[model samples]
Target chain A: MAYELYYWPTIQGRGEFVRLALEEAGADYIDVARESEGIAVMMRMMDHAEHPPLAPPFLKDGDTIIGQTAAILLYLGARHGLAPKDPAGGLWTHQIQLTIADLVAEAHDTHHPVGVGLYYEDQKAEALRRSDEFCENRIPKFLTWFDTILARNPAGDAHLVGRSLTYADLSLFQLVEGLSYAFPKATGRALKQAPRVAALHDAVARRPRIKAYCASPRRIPFNQEGIFRRYPELDR
Target chain B: MAYELYYWPTIQGRGEFVRLALEEAGADYIDVARESEGIAVMMRMMDHAEHPPLAPPFLKDGDTIIGQTAAILLYLGARHGLAPKDPAGGLWTHQIQLTIADLVAEAHDTHHPVGVGLYYEDQKAEALRRSDEFCENRIPKFLTWFDTILARNPAGDAHLVGRSLTYADLSLFQLVEGLSYAFPKATGRALKQAPRVAALHDAVARRPRIKAYCASPRRIPFNQEGIFRRYPELDR
Candidate 1:
């Protein structure tokens, strides 16, 4: 059976991270919410699955319903040669993935600072302040950290973990892409400060499978509805 | 060799989750930063280690330096028998740990909505508003999810992942403990709706090793500087 991935149909959001890894590996998986009965299957899992997932962007492979984007990638990474097999290498790769998660959450909070359910207009002032601080402080801090990691990677800066690409590399590509889309001007400045990181993003984009996926309709464009929302007022 | 755990000495913060795991498993570990020269070791790793950790609360076992509280727990969980042996069970355990991390971050944000570097006094207005939404919407949503997971657990409601104790149980205990201290009124009310979660918190506390650790000077008191800071105005 093809792996079942449940996420919102319209927004790439957290699901994009998992999708990128699956795409990069050319894994057989269904973007369930995009399927004919995807939404219903997702709803049933949310409502009544034996091991109900805490949220969407969960992967269902047989009996397991894996939630948390990082966890799903971690599961897939080992199986697909996208993660290290050695214990220490695996742990280091996971540590990097968790940091990427932190960056993603902060990106989401830049737009929805006060409340997730509230409209951006309702939290406009807070969102603006949050976004400004995020662009100035958080973006540089996180990007610089990643740049440092890449610089210090004994294997090479081409991949985050070891010689080959791992889920962390895929996730970092999505992070840069989302940040670049969400805050074009600020991301450009940050990219200049972290050239190696910029190079890695380019490298991941150039991967044949990744290149094909980017051009395919399967990859959703950044919009106001997703985590990396482009609000003119919030981003300078 | 004793695991070297490096974190800020004063605050329980994220490190406490790791401490709780180490304590519960009867694992020999050194709280590196709590020692006189501990801060320097942690600073050196941040500044100059070959694989510099993104932040503190990193664990040094032999040569591997693991960062991110959840990542640290994931590494220790298996070795200490604090996590499951099976692949699916381990993944599920880790998924719960990641969700607990989400809750911890939200708790931190409730007090620092505007900027992390800024003092809570500087961002009191925004913190007040953020905490209100957090306490009302986010807290209930997260707690209710945990409650449902516990209710639906086939192993037992006594633990988050399986019949055996996991690092997730230790972290959830700290979460409930922090919430109770920081938002007594709101947490008191939230606990009423999540009796199973509340029970797990109580059960973890009563564990002999955990009980001794809490009673000893090892367990730091909850303070304003930590993730679950008490600001009377924000809590109510």
Candidate 2:
């Protein structure tokens, strides 16, 4: 049976990370919420599944339901050879992915600094302050960390772990994409400072599957509603 | 060989989750940063370790170093039988852990709503708004999810994953501890609404090893400096 992926239908949010993994693995799956009446199905699953996911971006594989993007990737990565087979290498890859998730959360908070309950307009002042620190400190810091890891990878600078294309690499590509879209000026400068990370992003984009996926309708475009919104004022 | 646990020496923060697992398992481990000159070693390790952790609360067992609180527990949980032997059961435990980590991150952000670079006083206005939403919505939503999962567990309601104690149970206990410390009024009210979750917290506290560890100095007291802080103004 094809795997069922439940996430918000409109934007490349956290679900995009899982989508990249599934697409890269060439795994058979359905983006459940994007289909007609699928949002209802997704909500019902969240409400009544034997194992409920606190939020979307969950995967249902047969009787098993896996939530949390990193946990979902951890499940898919091992099964799809997208992570190292060895115990230590797999954990390291997972650690990197968790760090990426942290950065993504921080990015989301740039706009919703006061609370997610309020609109962007209601929290604009706080967002400005939060985004400044994010652009000045968090982005550079996270990018530098990714660059350091890429440069220090014993196998090669091209991959995050074991000279293989792990899900960390895919997620990093998505991170860079979202950051650049959200904060073009800041991320552009950070990318220049972290050339290896920039190169890795380009390399992942060149992957036949990822490249095709980006062009296809299946890949949602960046928007104001998603985690990485391109609010020009906040970007600056 | 004794395991080396690296984290901020003064605060329970994220490291407490790992410490709880280690203590409950009766594992011999060194709290590296709490020792004299240990913080220097911890910083240097982060600066130069092959698998560099973006931040602390990393564990080193001989040559293997694992970072990310949830990832560290994933490693320790399996070896200590704090998690199930089955792959599906293990992933379920990890999924719950990842969700708990998400709540922990949100709890930290309530005080640092503007940015971590700024002190809580500097972000007091934003913190108040954020904390209001956190107490009024996020906490209840998260606690209800935990309560629902506990109620729905097929094996029993006592454990988060299976019949036996898993790291998720321990982490959930720690989460309740932090929230209660940070927002006594709100958390107390929320706990009353989540009786199963409340009972689990009390049960974990009374466990022989965990009970002793809490009494021991090895368990740091919750203070204003940690992720969960008690600011009466912000709490209300």
Among these predicted structures, which one has the highest TM-score?
A: 2
Which residue pairs in candidate 2 collide?
Answer: none
lDDT of 1 by residue, A176-220 (tens): 999998999898999999998999999999999999999999989
Residue-by-residue lDDT tens digits, candidate 2, A76-176: 99999999999999999999999999999999999998788899999999999999999999999999999999989999899989899999999999999
Per-residue lDDT tens digits of candidate 1, residues B1-236?
Answer: 99999999999999999999999989899998999988987998898876778788899999888999988988899899999999998988899889889989989988877778778787777787888888887777888888888888898788887798888888889999999899998888888999998999999999999999999999999997888888888776
| iRMSD, per candidate, in listed order | 1.2, 0.6
Query: What is each candidate's DockQ, to 2 decimals?
Result: 0.76, 0.89
Poorly placed runs, candidate 2 (over 4 Å): none
Which candidate should be chosen as best, given lDDT against the real structure? Answer: 2
Evaluate candidate 2 and give its CAPRI docking class based on DockQ: high
Q: Report clash pairs, candidate 1.
A: none
**Weakest 10 consecutive residues, lDDT, candidate 1 chain A?**
A47-56
Here the TM-score of candidate 2's chain B is 0.99
